[model samples]
Each structure stands twice: as structure tokens, then as C-alpha cells.
Target: MSRSTFVATIEPVSTCPVNCEACPVSRRDIEQPKARLMSLAVAGAVASRLRHEFGVGYAAFGNWGEPLVHPQIVELLAIFKQVGIGSLYLTSSLSARIDAAALVESALDYLDISISGVTAEVYNIGHRNGDWERVEGNMHALAKARRESASRLKIGLRWHRYRHNEQQFDAARELAEQLGFEFKPYFGHLGGIEAHEDFERGTLPQSKRRFIENSVFLEYVERAVAAHVGEGSCPQAENLIIHSDGRLLHCCALMDSHKTGIDFLALPRRVLESFKRAPNSHCGSCLAKGWSGFMHSSKVDHRSPAEVAAELAPSSAS
Candidate 1:
């Protein structure tokens, strides 16, 4: 089967500064503390493979860590563009200092700023240890820089909606509009890959489960899980995830331990396509339990829980 679209998510930096509650990178138990930055040479090689071999349409930098933390992030973005990758983007927590003017002038196509709340009290619930003041200031500076330079770089404010932060959605959206940014609000989920693994094994920690039950929109999660039940194929098969160390991941939902062992730079497209067709045990488990669908931001259902339940009733009966 030929895929029409392919995406590559490259991790520019391995370590994150902010300890977000929902992110596995923040948890030492899940993600061992290791600081690694992808060299420009390696990034260029990866970008070449993605463009020349896989014909990747979209490339995203930063999966586990904050891309802005990298001192030469602008150069990294430029590397992908230099390799002819069409759409290049990255998401940032905006907790660290960044050269907004340099970024605006870079080859980046889009920048998504991840924000949980507008205020410190609510923001700290998820973005623990993150400096709200710094994030706010960076947001404004980036907007100003884009306007001043007349850059076409699309800026989006991705607000993670939690139970406590619902009331702050309009305020955040208003701010995004005022800054000429695209406002996107979606329900937050359990942060770590370990959390999803534990949930599947029924061994999720009580504290984590409580966080999900309280903070997340349970109905939306249920619909998302049910909508993909019995799915034999994974949408992520068309996407490639590369670690900062160049390890190729099966998908974003799995841990580093589950990496394919082949360095992305050397892995042939035929080998990756074969691997995608026959996923390992970890990927099998995720697909079987519908967590694969749940993890994708674009797979959510807007229909009510009852409507989704009714649609899935026949499959449940079988």
C-alpha cells in the first residue's frame, strides 16, 4: 500500500527543563535523565533520508524535549528545509529563553506553543516548575518578531484543556487572537508512554489514575478509545519518529526501549515499511487496546459518548 502522506518527528534535544505533570520526560522513573542534542550533521542526514527516501511531507522537531532548549534550534530547522522537506514545524513549552528574531527568520513553517493555562495557579497543575511569566513573555515576543519581520511562520497556541483549566480557555483564546496566533484547545491526557502501558496492563498508579479521572475529559477519552477498537491498521504507520540519538521508534506511544535498534540514518525505506507492516509486540498491544488511536491528536471524535457507544454496539456484540 502506498501512503499519500508521511511525517517525521525528530527529537532535537533529549532532555526537557520543565517538569510537566502529563509528560513522561519529566518523570525520572520513566525517562532516565540524559542530555543529548542532535548534531547538525546528523540532522542533515536524517532530513535527507526523510525527504529523498521517504518523501516525507511534514517534519516536526521535538517529541520528548522542548525544541527551544537547543541553542542552535534555528539551524536545525534550517537543515530540514535545506534538505527540501516541505513543511517543517516544532512545538515548544516556551519556558526557556529563545532568540525570537532568529527563529522568525528561519525556515520554520509553523510553531506551536504548548500552554495549559494562562495563570500560574492553574498552569502549574500540568506545567509544573514551568515559568508562566517567561512563557507569556516569549509568546508576546515571538508574535512581535513575526509581525516585524513579515514572516509567514504560522504560530499556534495549543491549549491543553483540563478540568481545572476549562474556565481559562476563552481567556487563552482571546490572548492568542490578540497576538495573531491560531488558538487550538484540546483535552489533556496522561503524559507518559509508561502511563499508557500501565493503563493497558491495569497497573496504572493510583495517583496517575486519579489525575486522569479528575483532570481529563473522560467522555472524550472513552469515545476516542471506542472509535478505534478492532482497528487492524495504525495511522502512525506512515509516520517516523527519531530519537536525538538517531534510534528509530516504532511509534511515539512506545518507549525508547522499544526502538527498532536500527539508526534512522542507515535504515532503508524498504526495511522500515516492512517493520511498519509487521509491528512488534509493543505496537500490537497498543493497537489492540485502541491506545494507538487515543494517542493521536487528530483521531478524537466530536460526537457524544452515547452516539459513539451506539455505533460500536454491533462490534461489542460480536
Candidate 2:
């Protein structure tokens, strides 16, 4: 049987200009210059592995780091195309440095941009200002790039929805249509200062709180699980993140200290081992009844004993 995994290259930068209300990384506030970009050598080595060792005919170049910030990103992508191996996916904040003509030449299979809202003010509440214009400009450029590329380069929007910008739904949908990209709204599990503060002050109001509680949220979770399971070919298995430092994590949603890092280049067995051993804390929580951790219950493997019992119990017969 042929097995496949979505190879996500996690490039981490030290700094981001945004101050969004749902920022996940604790280090977002550090008064420091941007972190170092991953060296071309490291990227090239990973590319080589994707082609040869992993037999990964499908790969992506973005995850943690802003692909736009890595000056060598385009170059690395070019090399991947040259190798004539697999599809390439690029996830970006749609910052300004994106070049339509150049990226179009990269022969990407899919391109996804993260857009939270249609207006700067709405986006600014969570992210920094320097990005607003650039993100907008990049979106336009990507639209053009998608049109020009010979290969079917899918352009799509990954919207991280928040209460402050919930009203942007219609406008964002319109923008997606105008930009020639598919729109996908995602409620982020993480929040920034403003969102946290609002929740703390009991300001989230009854309606919004109820929205979070209603079956709609469950439906979203189901969709997310179905999508992942479809892609992975395993409902119990999951997507994970292996950082540049070789840290194995249970995806960004359940990111925490319970991680394992090793030189995946030198130790492929270790990589597989970590996958078996390092199930996310959220996974454990999923086994506990009434647990409502970040890993949405609907996304959990419902075949588990707890889930089976809950579904088959007499009380649930009604």
C-alpha cells in the first residue's frame, strides 16, 4: 500500500508585526529583530528527503514561519519544481514581498493565504499595521499569479475568524470571489490579548457564547475531522508538525511542551517513533468524558471506547 503524508516545512521567524487578539506563541511580544530564516542547506536537504526517502509526491513549504519573510523561499520552491517531484503548497500571510510572476513560475499545486478580515482596522486589532497593505497587495498579486500559471495552482483563503471581525464574513466572502479564491472560515483555537481580555471581563455576551455552545460548532469540528481523515486515510492518525529544530508536535492547535525533537534527516526511525509515542495531550483529553479541550470532541477518533460507550448507552437512546 502506498502511504502519504503532508510534508509541512515549519520555518519559524523570531518576530511578527501583528498584535492580533488570538496570537498563540508566547514570544510574540519580545522586543527583538526577526528570527533567522532557515538556511538554504536545511531546506534543500528536506526537499531531497521529500523526493527520495519519503517518496512524497506532495509537499508544502509553509507552516509556522511566514513564507514571505524567507528571502530564499521562492528559490527553494524553484528547486522543488525543478526536481519534478510532487505538488507544492504555499501558506502565506499574503504579505507584500510576494511576487506574482516569480511565484507563478514556481509551479505550485496550491496556494493558501491567511486573511482574517476585509478591512485593516478589523485585522489590526490582532495583527500589526505594516502587514495590512502588504497582505492586501499580496492577495491581488496571488490572484493574478493563479490566473497566469500553466499548472492548476489553486488559490484559497484560510480565514481565522474572531468576534471582532465576525461581521467581515460577507465582505470576506465577496473578497474571496473577487480575488478568484475559495474561502474557508476557521475559528482559531488560540486568541490574543484583546480576545482573552474580552472573555475575562464577561463581555462575550450570551448570544456569542451560545454560538460557541450550539451544534454549529460541532458541525465545524466534524468537518475538520472529516477533512483530515480524508487526507490522511486514517481517522485515528493525524497531522503533526515537525519544527526546524526537529521538534515533533501534535499540530499547531495542540502545541505545548510535550514534544520530542531529533534530527529527522539522520534518524527516520526516530521520527516514526515520535509519531507513535507523542500523541497530543488533547488526544488524551479526548478519552475523558465531558472533556472540552482545544481538540474539538468531534475531531477526536470516535471509534475509541469512551466514544463507543457514549453513543451506545441507554441514556443516549432518546
Candidate 3:
């Protein structure tokens, strides 16, 4: 059966300057000895392959790293557009200096900005070492650029809700709405699937443990685990993640790219699908433990923090 719509997520840049606490990039779990940027030639080739071979209609830039860090980010977007990829989007922390006017002119469909809080103090709790002032300024610049150019580039503010940031949700949402951007708030989790596994095994680093205990919404984690343990296949199997080095990752959840032996430039779609379907140790463990479900949950628990705290109190006491 032909796939209706395949999505390709390519990482134009493979290093992030922002040190978000819940990101593997910040924690140094996914080691990058040196930063890498996908060359225009490689990106164009990958885009072409995704369009012609996989029938990928949608392309998203950014995975473990920030795409804005790349000097040729606009050119990278254009390459995908040139390949006839109908929909293209990218996610960014907006911590780096952004050329908002150039991005507006890039024929990009959407931009999802990852934010933890509106205020610097709370925002720093999750997005450590990130400058809230700079991110805010970038947001404004992008908004102004879109307006001035009359571009159809949709912007979204994805708020990573933590215990300390819930009160700021309304303020952030207001700001996004004021700028004609979509505001999304969801409970944040530990860094990666590896971190999630560590959390379950009570092996997380002391700092990460403290952050999870004090910041994350435990009720959401519990409910997600209850709702989806060994109940479904991995949703990530359908999507493709290409590293900046042109290697195909098993999934975005994977931390060690070296372990993924698949080469994006050479692997056939049928072989890739067969490999995706075959159970591997990492995916097997994540699936069996319900971490896959938790990560991919579509329904957000909108209960107040206090309510969730109350619900989880008994479990914590035990």
C-alpha cells in the first residue's frame, strides 16, 4: 500500500547554543564532538530523494539541534521548496540571532518557537543559559517581518509547561495571540527517551531528578503510562530523521547516531520500512515500558497544577 503522506525531518544544523534543561542537546547525552552543518548539495539531494522516492509532502527542519544556527538556513529551506516539497516548517529556540526578513522571504510554511516561560527567571529554569530577551525580540522581529511582507508564514509559540511556569501560561498565550501566533502549552518531560528510561529506573542524575520532582507534572506522566503500555506500535516509525551528516536515524528518540547504521543516501524505502518494522532492542524497551506512548500522547491533561498535585500526592507518599 502506498503511504498517503510521508514526513521528512532533516537537521540542517547539529548543535544548539541554548542549553534547555530537558533537552538531550543541553545535557550532553547526545555527544557531538564538533558541530556539523548539512551542505547545500546534501540537503538538496535528500530533499529530492524524499520527494521522489518516499512521496514526502511535508518537511520539518530541526531535530536534536537548532536549524537557525546554520548560516544557510534560508538556502536550506529554499532547497526543499525547489524540490517541490509542498509543506515545509522548522522549529527553533529563537535564542540565536535570526534574520527575520530573510526567513519571511524563504517560502516557509510554519515556524514553531520553543519557549518555556515568558519571564527570564522561569524561562531559565527549563531553557537554561538561553536569553529570554533575545528570543522575545526575535519573535517580535518575525512578526513584524511577516506583517510587512504580507507573508503567509504561520508562527507558533510552543510553551513547554513546567511547575514553575504554569502561572505564566496566560501571559505567554496573550503575547502569542497579540502577535498572530498560535500558543501551545503542554507538560514537559525529561530530556530524551534515555532520560525517561533513567527516570523509570531511578537512575537519573541528581540534578535531573530534582528538576523532574520539582518542575514536571507527575500526574500527566502517570496517566500517560496507564493509558498506553504495550498497546500500540511506534508512531515514530512512519517518520524519517536525517542527521546533518546525511545518516538516517532509527528515530528522533535515538541519542547515539553512530549506532544507526542506515545511510540515508543509499537505503531503499522497502528496506527502511522492513528495518523499521523489525523490533530492535532500544525501541523494544521503550515500547514495552510505555515511554513511546507517553512521548506521543495527543491528549494533554489540562487539570490545574494543584489538582494534579493533589491527585499524585497519595502515589508519592507511598
Cα-based TM-score, every candidate: 0.88, 0.67, 0.92
The predicted structure with the larger lDDT, 1 or 3, is 3
Ranking by TM-score: 3, 1, 2
- lDDT, candidate 2, 1-318, per-residue tens: 367554444443423444333443333332222346656666666667656665556655554456666666677676666655567787777664767777766667788887766778777655544468878887887778667666477887877654455567777878999988887766544332222233346764443333333312333333444443322122223333445544444444332322433455666744654564555444443333222232333222313223333543222112
Stretches > 4 Å off in candidate 3: 1-5, 299-318
Q: Number of clashing residue pairs in every model?
A: 1, 12, 0
Candidate 1's TM-score: 0.88
Q: Give the total clashing residue pairs for model 2.
A: 12
- Tens digits of per-residue lDDT for model 3 on 1-318? 486556888888878888777777776444552578999989988999988888888988888888999999999999899888999999999988989999988868999999988889988988888998999899999989989997889898887877778788778878989999987776787766878877888987777777888887666677776677875588777677788878777777666643664878887878887766665577777887787877777544456656655765433412
The prediction achieving the highest TM-score against the true structure is 3
Candidate 2, superposed: residue stretches over 4 Å from native? 5-9, 12-15, 26-34, 82-85, 128-130, 148-151, 191-240, 245-251, 254-259, 268-276, 280-283, 286-318
Candidate 2 lDDT trough over 10 residues, lowest sum: 229-238
lDDT of each: 0.76, 0.53, 0.80
